[model samples]
Target chain A: MSEWWTYRPSDFLLFVPRTYYRLLEHYGAGAWPWQVAALAAGLAVLVALVRGRPGALRLALALLGAGWIAVAWLFLWGRLASIAWSADYAAPAFVAQGALMIVLAALPLRAVDVSKPRRLGASALVASALAYPLLAPAMGRPWAAAEVLLLFPDPTAIATLGLLALLPAGRRAALMIAPLGWCAFQGMTLWTMGAPEAGVLLGAATVALLLPLGRTVRRRRDRAARDRPPASPGA
Target chain B: MPTTLDRRTVAAGFLAGGAAAALPRVARAQAPAPLAKTIPSTEEKIPAVGLGTWITFNVGDDADLRKDCVAVMAAFFEAGGRMIDSSPMYGSAQAVVGAGLEALGSPKPLFAAEKVWTSSDGPAQIEATRKLWGVPRFDLLQVHNLLSWEAHLDTLFAMKDAGKLRYVGVTTSEGRRHGELEKIMAAKPLDFVQLTYNPVDREAEQRLLPLARERGIAVIVNRPFQQGDLTARLEGQPLPALAEPLGATSWAQLILKFIVSHPAVTSAIPATSRVDHVRENLAAAAGPLPDEPTRTKIAAEIVKL
Candidate 1:
């Protein structure tokens, strides 16, 4: 038999793009009105995160965690597994991510950072809620097929990255792992199917991955400035 | 003698008469009887066109899509086509095909062609695949993509020797591993060999086709449309005037004709979900096939497009 590396991305994708989009449409149809609830829940979570109270952070984590579990059940297992066999394997990862979030929610809330990174994260969360659903319509698919925040994995993962950004840099990286991994897998799936929507997950993942590096750079610069002797006062 | 008026005789008479009456209606719904080709090993004749279940029938547990697949299968059988090919690797396709066969009342003419894909546990996997198809025995079971062919071929030949299978074969697709495939075709006592062969992808025409002819191994052509890419590419182009003589109305039929016209090809399995496309594919087997010069013209025309 041929080696595994000889295969291309297209080889792994069993169905066509239309079939994939139809799967989303079927999922949307089955989980109707809940999509609206999901969008509202996402907005509520974003609001809670922006407020940055200890209880509010817990509430945001709890909500995002529950949303991840729901998407795994409704979309990944219930709908996607019907078409893509790997969805069964993928659903457990989603469940694990959900479990992780809930566990984190029970922990003590650390100091929140209301910096540029946090603002960027907030913008991403807003996009997940408001702009994500419009992507289906933008791509000429029916609105019924729109991928709503907290209702689908992509937007939910992006929203998680957003909320993670609001936490201290040290606490954020470990939590970012699951959502970033999901983004890569989902992005590759869509990319292989030739769907331009892959960019949404990939772009969010790239930015989320780089945010900590950017934060570390700014911290090192600040520390150097603070430790530097008598900033030329003698001169 | 007076006809029997007993309940058993009366019921038997009604069933026989009803089946006789319903047979022609099913026949009339399809095109003319599909063309048949001879299997050199046993001289058994099968339709030149067959149904393929690669991506088309992988709709897992979806009742609506399963119904669609049943409709396609029903159309295929009504058209007198057999030799439905599938593999375990095609997601839920084997289950979908099983469901379709059950839904169609397990048509008697079904030529269940399956594959052994796993690197180990060939017998167990074949049994599982048999359960999936809901058939007593497969007409043919092949080593899928030549995976562990040495072991699986031994199992398959053993089954054939034990009368558990009617034929033994091996398969490859997308023109991959043709060298190894060629070596096996030359060495093994294979009843059938399937590979990708379309108008555009005619690499098999040079070696494998002639080798199959020499070895008396039947050729089952898969991806006759390059998994629908070739047809999609030729969609808007006009069928050459020569296609009129072959009674090909669509590009799918024209392309199928081009594949099966070769003397070495025993059957071409074109996978499709649409009812009309299945009928059209089977229809290509009907009427006159293209001659060699015409086959070249068909290939040339598709390339020019």
Candidate 2:
């Protein structure tokens, strides 16, 4: 009776990696011309952010919420659940996340202000949104194999992190939690399945999380120092 | 064409025939019965070869794939197979088995086997699984991978005592939890213990097999094909001259036979979605098992490959 830890990594794998990638290819095929659709949506979100209109972030959150719900219904619950049993539980969790986004959109906990645009952060998000679909094709897979932002998961998660990265220090840190968690999750999943892009995803997640977290910690420490009693002169 | 058929083609034909035979009731009765081994705990015998439903039968909500699995079950039973092993952890495997059996009219010979997975939810899971299988009870109920075996064992014992389960057991696979498994086998009263063992992966032979013999627990070998590694290695290789004496026509049969041939083993449940593979697996039970000397020779030759 060896312990569970004695089991090899390959032993936990229920299905081969090929079966998993086949699901991706199938999803790409099912949601064709998704490139145009994702671009249109991304552009709408971009315009709203750029115009800095009243409640622009609100609209963006609503749009993101709709996208998350769509993914939960169309992909997680609909497609993946057909192939993998874990999706039974995971689908509901995704639904909850989408619903949370909707709740956040309806009532403002964090200020919906992107008035002062951070060009670097905004560009990172837009680039991720625009370029994600090309990744699979560039890797030599068919066009039907590309992962789109709204239709596929990896790009969606990556692009979410990029967008959240632009939210300044205070609110961005809170929002980064989900995307960072998702990156860790999706990264491990792809890595276990031997996908080539897993390393890039994990690395991106680390940067996205660490940069914000490091800034937050420095800010908190500085605040504590300032709030403290005047330092003892020579003591 | 001088009545041509190579060994591979012949083997394929034999496998396909196993599937096709399921369509007619008459052909099934005429088929020869597979060899069986008795469960030492209860003296009840089951076919030496059985069906496994791990990744193979978890075709969640895929109608066409589910149909394909149904066809595989048809092939399995048509080939004289009986015991079928599954778990709740394997997604919709138990449900798929229920669906497949319903499609086939529920053969009386089916030795339904399943596992209780949770520490507290053992009874609940068992009840849910029974409803999923559309059956009243299971032939064998095991603690899945010995996950909190002690806590689950209490429920299993009560169930067996209450007549909800015929046999109470525990299982592990891919050589996982062998040391703890050894402790459970020695301390906990069990009727069955499942593990992974194949010609290429013989880690179980050292302690688990010997311990099973001493404790009088029946063994069921899983991953008998190493999840297709063995098949990939021997896909086009011709049947060795040594195989002729044992009446083995395919690599799948040869490997499965090696597993079930062990004196302590009661069955080997190899999962396969293909009807051909199911037939190939069941074919192992139809022939003579290798003796200790022959087993050594076979292992030596297989290692060289």
Candidate 3:
């Protein structure tokens, strides 16, 4: 389970642009990349929270650096002026920022204390709330909904979210249900509006939510095992 | 009396030979007539259908899949097909095709056309394409989708002049840059031009097909079934009664025949992942083509659907 959550943003980013470029070409939209970037960044934060791995943060940063270089190439060398302010442009920027946040979140800012359950719960709630807005627009109606569904939040995001939601305890339930509910609500709204973009956004967000929810469920199971007394001999 | 006897003996010998020749007379047989028109490239006439190696054969590193592809090619060859068009852009298709040919004992393909897809390395691109196909000189070398065509054309023309390549051409699919293709064909001397032309996408018929015919360049039709979209559209629909007279048994045959029946279309290269499809596509070349009126009727039938 822990093994599944670990992934580099760079690995996913390497192939994402190729698909993103194709989508941009197909739909003639400029804003698709921005949603993708925001989704990527949100995913990095989610991974950091679940795994507490500093290396994952570094990998995310490297991916962002490469993604920015690609953006520069497209704008300056390719002379595709539309890409400069396009959603494609915004996507990588969000990814880079998201990766940076993950690094910050992973830093050992204070002494470790296992007994501080209340503080940890409060911090988790605060982090989830803060990350919600960053991940929200990528899930709602308008602009490149189909492409967002097909490409954004990508496979890595889904795997990370699933890992996070698998952690032990009631917190796992909260982590799993909140994102699923948010996605379902967003999806319903998008459907009502006849907005395909909303559906695409919702799909990406659902995948993103799965990683954290999975990790949370897994953590809960582990904590339950540790807390439970050993089985009596011959019982 | 002795001199008279010698003269008489010579006359008797001539008389015997004449008598032997007069025993029976057999009528001389006439020689078989030659083909009305000579094929441009080789003495052997090429079939109107060709094969395309695109996404299907481009599966890389999977040995079992590669073997299946080789079997598909063998089936294609057995069905009396010849030409194969591939590109460097299509992953390992060229390599896979080459391996298939090697596995099948390297039967000589009538025509092999490859494309240079990228910029910045004209010579290296050509070299790599040659190495991948294991052909010393390709029959046709085209500039793929006009990606850096200007730079590649110079190298292609040089290769053609130097006998490194038998023919030089350009290809563009997906209805992209039709005007550019027209401009290049108009200004340049090319032996062939490849483009998409299925029933659904008849946009190429308005200008490109006519221009190729006028320019006397061989035309190769790609995506003859609109990349399976046409097939999906006609799924469960029976072959029209009119297609039987034109000798088309299936939709694949009907579509390929329509593309090849054009006076300018030298061949139509339809990519297929299945051997049955390759055989079916090749069978389109075996019989009489639909006449102009019949073609119009077929088109009308399709449009009505």
Candidate 4:
């Protein structure tokens, strides 16, 4: 019966920028209202995913995805972020973050099994890691503390790994730990370099790491086939 | 000899004279005047003058009336003129222009310029503009009157990188924000800037025009007659004899030629609701532009009018 029930995720994404502008103008520096709205939307998406309503989840993801992109774009090009940094610096950072969010949101994360969510999460993590180097050309700044501070870990990867680790031990120990270990290695690398380019190098390294794991999976499959008893004659 | 001067000879002479009389008419139909410049966007070399469909398109009967408007547009284009400037705030002008283009068989327009008005609607607005014009990419897009300009610039830059837009610009009219417009021209990398500049409103000549020249930004003049205000002022006045040297047949051509003569001005868009007016505007693009002394004399004459 409420208008909010009929709202779609895409609409929410578009609506957020307009709402953010008004709220930012009204509250100015107090961005709590925007953060709360974003959190609520994220919660709704989580609920939809748990309920197996893929359509709802997608729409919700799209909304938050586009909304975040719009916000980043505004900060990059509009008055808010332009006040703090030069247009040249602010704009590229906004573009990089917005592009990362859109790609993450559009990814088919819902299709991955909860039993093996870490694989998909790791892939996203690697993809975002590699995206940094490509973004450097646009940023046009030498790697500095301020530039390095802009590279934040993919939040979706963090959320997915956290959920997977909380599952039963057998699933957690075998499936979740591998991705967690990889992420830890990546985190360590990022800590040492403290530059955006390092994030890209770490991502490239993950792809190299996945190659050996793929071969192990293939060998295990072959071994399992050899051990299986020959099919009995029709009895 | 006496026999040759008889009825047959008289008939032959009459036919030859008729053919000679009809030759000029055929030549006039065959070769329309050559355009001043060919916009690199298309094969057609467009005349330097064009129509700006802002306020006039809004006052029309309805969107469907654009069918008639297409004829007005066709008159301009068919006469070797191109370029049409519109904005979203101009109500259904973009849609009407789109319709007109479709009705006219979608001839390759020399230049299509539109603007994004709202900060939040920048991307959608650009997308909508592309769709409305049925153009693969717009030749030029400006931030209308500096409204939400920064937001529009972001979308524009992305579009430009993707080759969805060829050029980006900003505009101001009525000489209201010359200061702000000048600042943007100085700070931002722009291809063009639209503003009001006529003999009547010479404020832009002092700074904005010179700055555009220095910056290499093309200028598109709008409200050249102050939306008919200058024409009203010169209503009863006869054409000055000095305009003859510039090949300006009427006050319209004289005024337009003056604006287009400026090195910074790429083109001038003066809107008209009638086909005759479009023809009159197009005539300014026919001959060589006014020189410095000629321009000064034209300005002095306008003061007298």
TM-score of each: 0.86, 0.79, 0.58, 0.50
lDDT of 2 at B66: 71
Q: For candidate 4, what is the total of clashing residue pairs?
A: 1
- For model 1, the stretches where C-alpha displacement exceeds 4 angstroms are A16-19, A52-55, A112-114, A137-144, A168-171, A216-235, B1-30
TM-score (C-alpha) between model 1 and the true structure: 0.86
What's the TM for chain B in candidate 4? 0.84
Instruction: Please say which candidate is ahead in TM-score: 2 or 3.
Output: 2
| Model 2 alpha-carbon miss at residue B273, Å | 0.7
TM-score order of candidates, top first: 1, 2, 3, 4
Give iRMSD, candidate 4.
19.5
User: CAPRI verdict on model 4?
Assistant: incorrect
For residues A1-235, write the lDDT of model 4, one tens digit per residue. 1233433222111111222223223322333334445445445545544554445544544543454344445433453332222333534543544354345446554343332344444434423433332343454532221111112223323333333322333333443342344345434433443435445444544543453355458779999999999999994
> Quick one: best DockQ, which candidate?
1
- lDDT agreement of model 1 with the native: 0.82
DockQ category of candidate 1: acceptable
* Winner by TM-score between candidate 2 and candidate 1: 1
- A-chain TM-score in candidate 2? 0.76
Residue pairs with backbone overlap in model 4: B38-B45
Residue A159 in candidate 2 has what lDDT? 64
- A48-93, model 1: which lDDT tens digit per residue? 7667777887888889899889888988888888778788888998
